[model samples]
Target chain A: MKEQILKNLSNYLELLQERFGHEKIWEELLISVAEYGDSDIYHNSIKESLEKILEVMKIDEVLCALDIITDKIEGFPKEDLLKYIIYIKNEYCLEKENNLREVKEALTELATPIIRIWHDIVLTPLIGTLDSERAQAMAEKLLLFIDANKAKYVILDVTGVPYIDTVVGGFLMEMIKAVRFLGADVVITGIKPDIAHTLVKLGVDFNNIIVKRDLETALKYVINLIEKR
Target chain B: MQERVVPIIKIYDCLVVPIQIELDDTTVEKIQKQILSEIENNDVKGVIIDVSMVDIIDSYISYTLSETATMARMMGCYTVLCGIQPQVALTLAQMGVNIKGIYYAMNLENALEILAGIEE
Candidate 1:
């Protein structure tokens, strides 16, 4: 049985190389096939091999490879082969989803970081688009940071942020108010022209908040404020 | 029966009014009247309305506070609102109630400092 399975696998591999002409696919097939031995292990190894093949080759090509092997091996159940194909497809999709989730979480962590630039001064540099969810997460994180650090001045530098909508603007206002309640004054910097226009059109009142044109000016103002204190 | 009056403590030329109780429409009106009267009687330069102890402020109270500030300004008394809790500010902002043109300080000490600066 082992010798026959090995012979059929070699034929399928040759056919795949001839059709795809990809060295990577052959390497993946070899690794997946290495696990082929006992009945239970063989079933799992076949599923893995199909997944790797589906990644590089089309489903029709995989089916053709299975057909070639089935003809040589007597009593090779066609239903079992189809079931393995379905299982591999589902596993591949699940893995892709998990990878995407991990990347999104990493990006969120990288985008919002509260740095204590000076004594009594905390700076949160926002990057990417300020969506409502990210804004809320940022707000919660910032409030906790201000309370823990006893921050007197918070500079929300939006130089890295590409744009802000009305929902995000509301979130930012709430964040500013919460920070103020913690006895910390908040300064919003790097308001781009388009974003400023959007905010105005949205009727977001900036009267209560201190806004600076750039980080440099904000830093200067903070320095003067600390000095005065 | 006499109306409840919000106490106004005279600290030099600055009138310090600490709002220790929740304000209804009548109480807000009474406080406004008391503050304006104190400002007029003593020729106070600044009025500090400390809302630090007050937990909640509805739109009516917010409107009254802003109106009182404007009234005090008309009487030549600068008004400083001090010690607004974070939750109160957030709630007020969410309710679209803003007291613009009124100065805000983090605490009574900062409020006094701001008043002193304005007096100079």
Candidate 2:
């Protein structure tokens, strides 16, 4: 994409210079606009490159270029400039959205981190609150991991979690059930007092799950279970 | 007259099924029958169906499999499904199949391990 942009750079800059009658032109600005204005996106880096333009070029020349493009100048080719602005604006919006989506994906992965703490055991330390989307994402990851690793036990640590409602409790149960289907036992540890109270009040059953007081107890219990088996 | 869809090899008391062909509704139904009969004939304690080579398993096919596992459970035989492709698993999970009455494993070895555990 960058190579393609470079190939068309001369023609595009020549056209702009001919239309605006600006003898001194900024090649980097045009390239940056074309480059960052395409599929690739690092919003801050693009903005920083734009800021770097102020250090090297005269501010008035840049302003004049902007004004002409924005249709402030008399007898400016109105249609083509409008089309260019529309295209750049649309591309900028799309690039920003892509950037946001990437951040969201990374955040989801970071939020529900699953660590293989030992042989036949994986530990997922739950952080923050749970929503349906986040819960489903976590469930998919956990289920696949269980199947791939042929895991024997999973310790879910929720000590960092602030609260758990009935909805959250349901999500946890569903995740546990999916893991069970994959033939791996799940041991959820580190339930806070508030979460425990919420769980009890909600009348959630603990028959299917093995819960321990802390991470240490959970690991010891799993080791013992493994040994006996 | 229908023929057998996949070979069912016996390893210890467990029947290992590697289903490599594409499964139409009829094929899966036949496979189900084959597995059930093998359970009775061999006194099979467990069945492991490997679907790694199969590319796709639609809703009907999955339903047939679930039913077969249920039937096997009633016959005092455990069913463990192994090596389901990632895409198929995603589709099944989205279809909201609980995959009840059946277990899952990573591969043949793991499936055998699960069956051995159940024996204990």
Candidate 3:
């Protein structure tokens, strides 16, 4: 069983290399096999392979590798398989999240859509700690959802968010810009006092995003804004 | 599945219930059973659901909390949620789970004050 599993992994690697190109396969496919293949291969083999690939790989290469592994092994229990995938995904998320620092410097380069008004979609919620990358992702996702649904307004509620920094503050402003580009009004709600103080200390301007104390107020504002428009 | 220790204490005629767990379905069921019996047994005028220890609050848990508040109100008991984690509160808010009618406080002591006010 052990030898067969190694053979199968090598064979699968060969196929992956042929189909996806060696660099793509090497970066992406290697992690999945090492993680989920029959419980025969030595852990050392997995670690050594990972270490060699990681040493020279770019951030994108590592992210691609994680994505591939997550796609392939998501079905298995995290205890059994997905743990490694999650570890890589978290690393990828953190890496990309950190990459947003570069984006903050090039804030003018950010292409935020015009806020459009859609009467159909009821509410839009923004969850997760809004780092620049996650904020950008959320902004883009919100725009897409608004445009696709012709949503009249979106509620950007951040009450569940634990903390925010200067980068995240800028990201929120960028999100407001993006939402505006989609012709949708975005109501920013759930601003806890600590985050509000952080925004003030960071010297970030939220003049454009409509502010509300909480979701109920945001929802009420959304309803009124939609009604008036 | 760690057992949560909730002490039922009387503070100026109101029942102060300090909850120490995530407000998920499992915890909600346990709480519902516990609080209902406690409310019936004590005939308290107010209840404080302390959530300082809860880390996560999805829509399901929010709905349960909201329902609990409603039921408490129907039974003539005021309910308040205390020490809600900011992250959990944010998620619940975005998910459109409004604990609108229920009182919210920063800590168990503050919640007790709010409940005590209602009791008096």
Error of 1 at A88 (Å): 19
Model 3, range A100-190, lDDT digits (tens) per residue? Answer: 8777534423322233333543354544455666665555555555545655467766777777887787667655544443334567788
Q: In angstroms, how far off is B19's CA in candidate 3?
A: 2.0
lDDT of 1 by residue, A1-229 (tens): 4555555666656765776656466545444444342344346556665666777778887787657656765655555658777887888799999999889878888999999999989999999997887787777777667656766899999888777888887788777766765557889999888778777887776776899989999999998999986
Report DockQ per prediction, comma-separated: 0.20, 0.22, 0.01
Which of 2 and 3 is ahead in DockQ? 2
- Please give, as one word, the docking class of candidate 1: incorrect
Interface RMSD for candidate 2 relative to the native interface? 3.3
Better of 2 and 3 by TM-score: 2
Predicted structure 3: lDDT: 0.60
Candidate 2 Cα deviation (angstroms), residue A52: 8.2
Please report how far candidate 3 places residue A204 from its true position, in Å: 24
- Candidate 3's C-alpha runs over 4 A off are A1-229, B1-5, B22-24
Q: Which has the greatest TM-score?
A: 2
- Per-residue lDDT tens digits for candidate 1, residues B54-116, read 889888998999999999988898888887766676677567676855787777887887788
Evaluate residue A195 in candidate 2 and report its C-alpha lDDT on the 0 to 100 scale.
88
Q: lDDT by residue for model 2 over A12-125, one digit each (tens)? A: 567657755442334655555555655434444445444554444565654566665435223333343334445555776899999999998888899889888888999999
**Cα lDDT over the full model 1:** 0.77
Off-target runs (Cα >4 Å) in candidate 1 are: A1-110, A140-152, A173-186, A192-197, A200-213, B1-4
